[model samples]
Target chain A: MRGFGVFTTIALLIAGCGGGGGHGDPNPVQPTSTPAPAVTATPIPTVNLVLQLSSSVGVAAASFSVGYEAGRGSFSGSGAQAQCQLGSSDTLAVNDDDAGTLKVAILPADPTRAQNLALPTTLTCSFDETGGTVTTAGLRIGDKKIGVIDGNGVVVAGDSSRLDVR
Target chain B: MLLVVAAVGHCARGAYAAGAPSCADPNGDGVDVIDAANVLRAAVGLPSTCASAPAACDLDGAGGIDREDALDVLRRAVGLAPTRDCLPHLQLTEVVHDLDLPLFVGAAPGDDTRLYVVEQTGHIRLVKDGTLAPTPFLDLSRTISSGGERGLLGLAFHPQYVATGRFFVNYTDTAGNTVIAEYRRAADPDVAEPTAARVFFTVTQPFANHNGGMLAFGPDGLLYIGLGDGGSGGDPMNNGQRLDTKLGKILRIDVDAYPTPPSGNVGGGDPDVWDFGLRNPFRFSFDRGTGDLYIADVGQDRFEEIDFEPRATGKRNYGWRITEGTHCFDPPSGCNLTGITLPVAEYGHDAGCAVIGGYVYRGARIPGFVGRYLYADFCSNRIWSFVRDGARLTSQVELTDDLDPTHALGGITSFGEDAAGELYVVDGPTGLVFRIDPE
Candidate 1:
């Protein structure tokens, strides 16, 4: 039953994926927070790492959480938005304070809007280098892994080539 | 929460691009958290962002997207039973017209294409493949008394109808007595062998008005019969409380053994009396999905009711003259309500007069209606539905507006469920039969 449901949902997603080619949003939406106390401090270097889903199959929905060493730096931006143009879709990014991770959920409001992302849909995460270096090994998707629903409602099992952070 | 609400409101006001699909997903992506959130907002009476794709949100087809729709979407997101199909809107599609005061509609077991309609003039007509057969399936007009609730009223095909070719009927004989008779199907599948009707049970009716002519086969394979309290106003004969008489009671008899009472019936009464104390149980049915019983008992003066009993519950005394729909009737002010089972749902005469019982929807065509009980009023051209959750009645929805928008199908005589469990409506006054279809 679970397999069938997954298949059905994926198949519906495929219907949403219309035209290919992703649309990039250079400007990222920022999260709001209280102003920190002003003081003379060393400039912290910011690193923008792009988490890309590079599979051939178009995705209508995707869910994954980004985890990193909190002591290294905080996620400078609010959340991730789709670079792929799926019309009338919503992406929800929530920061889990206890787990020290940012959970992102991308779904199309209308199924027909599901489309293939740019060759690599990039989710740029800005990291403030506090103590350790933010390397590809240090950055990882959460233990739940990345769940990408393709046009056929099948969960695209993420391999190194399909899902990557750089 | 505030941010989400604000985003949804903004989306609701956003104009749909030309040629865009009708759904809330602005990006035209598949259903995800955003759509579910929008549906949840609409369910709570807030504006739904699904203005663009409204059909995508109204999953169960009860008209207007609500909480259930939202829940269905959420369930789909998580891979649940209902996918993205919107609940089909209830529309009365005329299937057959020009019958002679049809009172009930049914279908033979294993027969999916034909509908058997019982005419009050004592002929069971067949509507096969959407066409009414010119010849009546069984004609008893000459054998039974016609007019005013007399004549042939109910029919039930045996579960093994294809094999045994046996069926049953409940009607008032020429002498005005309630008769449970068995008949066989002729060589032609659409015809009943009229000469072979073996009358197995007959109870004399004191008055013509409340004969309570409804017959059904229970899940236990026993023939259950409905009879009104000996007739007249207020059940003057007081037959409802008496078990010795089958009047005003639902009797369960083993037709296979010819009039023998099924074991575990009401103790010490007329051995076949399963339940007593009903004024006129005009219509009742056993849920095909759960085997539970639902009876639409016609009231005396004030209230009409829908009574329910879980499967296997025995000897329940539904208050009739003692109480008309949870209110004291016989003693007028304060009669003993103890030990008497009240109706699960009731409405006053202000709403409608005579409750016409219906079946619990177990049909595959309407996913939203599954498990919900649908019934109607004989006087008021209205149909209502509710889902019984344990002992509580919830999700009560009046479907008159959605189904009979013009009220042209006057006087809903009964609600019929075919072999597949899809329901139909019988209009006695208009001599019409309508299948409930998704609009």
Candidate 2:
């Protein structure tokens, strides 16, 4: 029992480590202020995908998928869109971790007017084992390529850069 | 090593179990948009405490939680079961925008770098390398009357544009005549010399509005033209059924094959007319896969129709003044429906005002959506598609529902497709271009 408790404590500490040394806000509305876990002199196995879109038309929903080469570890995280999906802003729901598919939508959003830039969302997938190649595909902007952002602050439309898993 | 695998197995199992659908009750408010919004917030790195039932947010019950789960939950909350095959969840991504009244958009035969857009004010704008080129391909504003339903209306590139560099445009000239003219690309390959235009044919218009101005190169490499029944309501000139007028006709000419000046082609499409008796065929398209032709003919008072014909369907008379949408028009009762080609599908004003013809979903991206004919209504802003089950093209389904509740596809003027067979749509009111992408 003591050993189990110690391991649980270690796991919580890792979860509390918000990429950087700081803590995550957990406010549910404000943008999460941390980048994905950064690799130090000793590389850590984790990657984050920050997808941002600005459309002349409003964004009601969006979905995407990510894949990694073998040994890249499994990924999992849905930050805000899940809250938007379930009609609550205060709830934390990590969703869309199956087969790498993620989905989100703003219900009752504008049906006529052109929307300005929408706040970006992130898919933080944690890979336990790392070292190889990481690619992102299946961004669901109605099957069209829209703008996207990487954790390093690079934003592009349709085209994306692959991450080295080392 | 066994312990390590066992520990990872326990973690994966716990993650999946924790993400079960019942965990979505963060605030105990039941699964709702607030919860869905909370999921979105979480996915985008926002802080949310689905502390109550976090797994509820994991609608898919996958080991991890993300927006796809949120989407499934949102859909269930909204009572929508997505039928992936029946509907084309097409999303339009804007390709280009901001120009004067873009009437139609056409892509050249072989060039994938540029999209040729015809503006109603007599200019052909080029969208090259993802941005609008500063120079106009050809500006006939000085020669065209830029008013209601006139100006440079339609554009069609030569089948071998790489070799010929020649293309045809249909427009109403300053003298109020429908002009079929050909222009060649300049030596620069990016810009075309407007002065090098050769007039192919011209028909004087008695009235304006019904001037059907759409040009396309048939699969057989011949140029096809769409014309309206000579304007003033009810086919006033009785031109639709009259075998002598170019008005109310879908003309076909061997302009590229002839490679010469006009011989004043007229009646019975002698030198160039392929078919006649149409009322304002606002738009038309040829199936890139089957070479079948479709014409969206604007109705007189009641219905908007889509007429279809096989590639070799020569000498067709789509009864316009005589019949509208398979119904009697001129005589109203005794009008003969025989011999004249009929519309494959049609809708009344209760549905929309004008029809914008569209392309077949032959693009390689969406396999399930293949073979479906996509089209739209200008007034309703609704998009629809259907596949032919047999000889009859049934199974009509609405594809633009999601768009309707979130955006206005303002006045769909025309549809275009790229060299890759990807589809595009144009709305006159927004003066924008959108590509149809599968969901």
Each model's lDDT: 0.72, 0.63
Instruction: Tell me the DockQ of each model, to 2 decimals.
Output: 0.04, 0.02
Identify the leading candidate in terms of TM-score.
1
Candidate 1 lDDT, tens digit per residue, B1-439?
Answer: 0001011111122242233222323224564444555565555554444554444455543345665675555544433345445434578889999999999999877889999999999999999999999999999898888788788888988888889989999888899988888999999988989874688878899998798988888899888899999788999989999978999999888888855667889968688899999999989999988889998899988888888999989699999889998789989997998879988888877777888999999998777668888888888766777677776666555566567756677799998989899999999989999988877
| Cα misplacement distance, residue A48 of candidate 1 (Å) | 14
What lDDT is reached at residue B79 by model 1?
Answer: 33
Candidate 2, residues A1-166, lDDT tens digits: the string is: 9999999866655555544334454532322346789877866555454344334432333322333343444344333222222222322223343343343333323212211123333333443335544544423322232223223222122231221111
Worst ten in a row by lDDT for model 2 chain B = B1-10
Tell me each candidate's TM-score.
Answer: 0.63, 0.59
Clashes per candidate, residues 3 or more apart or on different chains: 29, 62
Complex DockQ, candidate 2: 0.02
